[model samples]
Target: MQKRSVILAYILWLFLGQLGIHRFYTGRTGSGIIQLILGAAGWATTGILIGWFPLFVLWIWLVIDIFLIPGMCRNPE
Candidate 1:
């Protein structure tokens, strides 16, 4: 059985998603950085209501990520 990163990622997504913490937890450093920047910029520039769209997308992305992280974590030998 493979060790899954999904649960951890989901938790981060649920809580620290605006900081892109979930992406970092999932080993997607580049995307994490991007999300962090976008999220921050959006919040700073537009406030929560306008910034929410990307956050919503991130939420959906996190949900989808739950199915993917486990597979990506599968050990190959």
Candidate 2:
């Protein structure tokens, strides 16, 4: 059982978090897919002005993740 790295988790969370890449790295595949869809929709619809809602939700989730990353790195299950 390899341990996940807090630093790497944080890095992914910072760079690719909105798409839930960090979650995927921590083995949270279901949430990762949901976040991926939300992020994709946010980017794809931003131009037409329908994406802001999901983006806002994702932004809040990412903020919450700031503290969650450490636990995620530890468990990753």
Candidate 3:
């Protein structure tokens, strides 16, 4: 398996993490798609308070991913 870079992953996470672009770059397509959908839908439904939950969760997840990303790189598929 090809090894991913921690630095690139951090950069992606810093910039595009909100839309799950960092997950995609890290070879987590499933997570990326889920985040993408949630982010898009969250923006679309912003008029209601319910939409903020997913975005909030995603933000927390992304922040946690800062530590998790190195592990992901260590065990790539």
Candidate 4:
């Protein structure tokens, strides 16, 4: 497998973390999918107003991932 880089991870986190692309890059595919679904659902449900909740959750998750990225890049479990 190609090695992961902290730089690339941060870049993806900055640009695509909303979809959990950074998590996928870090080999955390399971949680990545959760983020993916949450992001999609959050956006999709906006018309109903209930989407704010998921979007809020996703935002918090993204913020938390900012700190977790380095460890994920290093260990990648």
Candidate 5:
């Protein structure tokens, strides 16, 4: 397997994580798509009164990802 760069992954996570870019970069396509959908939903509904909820969840998810990145960078068996 190819080596993954934690720095680059974190960079993606920092800049484009709302769109699930970091997850995609780390070879996690499924969760990436889910994040993407959630992000889009968050953005799409932001104008509504209840829209902030998805964004809030997304924030928590991203913060949790900060801890998961090292494990994500590990090579697959």
Candidate 6:
């Protein structure tokens, strides 16, 4: 596998995280899919009252995820 830049990954995660493109770029397909689903859920459910909390959690999760990508990509399989 080719080496991926952590900085680029972080930028993508911070900006287009909801699309899971960052995750895919980092070779984390499972997580990318999960993020995509959760993000979609958050987006679709927003403004429905009950969805507010989940959306907040998802946003926070995305932020944390951005920080974690470097460590995850550095790990040896």
- Give candidate 6 regions above 4 Å deviation: none
Provide the RMSD of all predictions against the true structure, rounded to 1 decimal: 4.1, 0.9, 1.2, 1.2, 1.4, 2.0
Candidate 5 residue pairs that clash: none
Q: Quote the RMSD, in angstroms, for model 5.
A: 1.4
Better of 1 and 4 by TM-score: 4
* lDDT tens digits by residue: candidate 5, 1-77: 77688999999999999999988888899889989988899899888856688889889999999999888888532
* TM-scores of all predicted structures: 0.61, 0.94, 0.87, 0.93, 0.91, 0.77
Q: Which lDDT values do the candidates have, in the order given?
A: 0.68, 0.91, 0.84, 0.92, 0.88, 0.77
Candidate 5 regions with alpha-carbon error over 4 angstroms: none
Model 6: lDDT to the true structure = 0.77
Candidate 3 at 76: error in angstroms? 1.9
What stretches of model 3 exceed 4 Å from their correct place? Answer: none
TM-score of 3: 0.87
Per-candidate total of colliding backbone pairs: 0, 0, 0, 0, 0, 0
**Candidate with more favorable, higher TM-score: 3 or 4:** 4
Q: CA shift at 73, candidate 2, in angstroms?
A: 1.0
Residues 2-73 of candidate 2 have per-residue lDDT tens digits of: 679999989999899988999999988998999999999999999999999999999998999899889888
Give the range of the ten consecutive residues with the poorest summed lDDT in model 2: 1-10
lDDT for residue 38 in candidate 1, whole number 0-100: 73
lDDT of 4: 0.92
Report the poorest 10 consecutive residues by lDDT, candidate 3: 68-77
lDDT of 1 by residue, 2-64 (tens): 354666756777788778786676566887898788777767756547777766776676668
Better by lDDT, candidate 6 or 1: 6
Query: Candidate 2 — which residues are off by over 4 angstroms?
Result: none
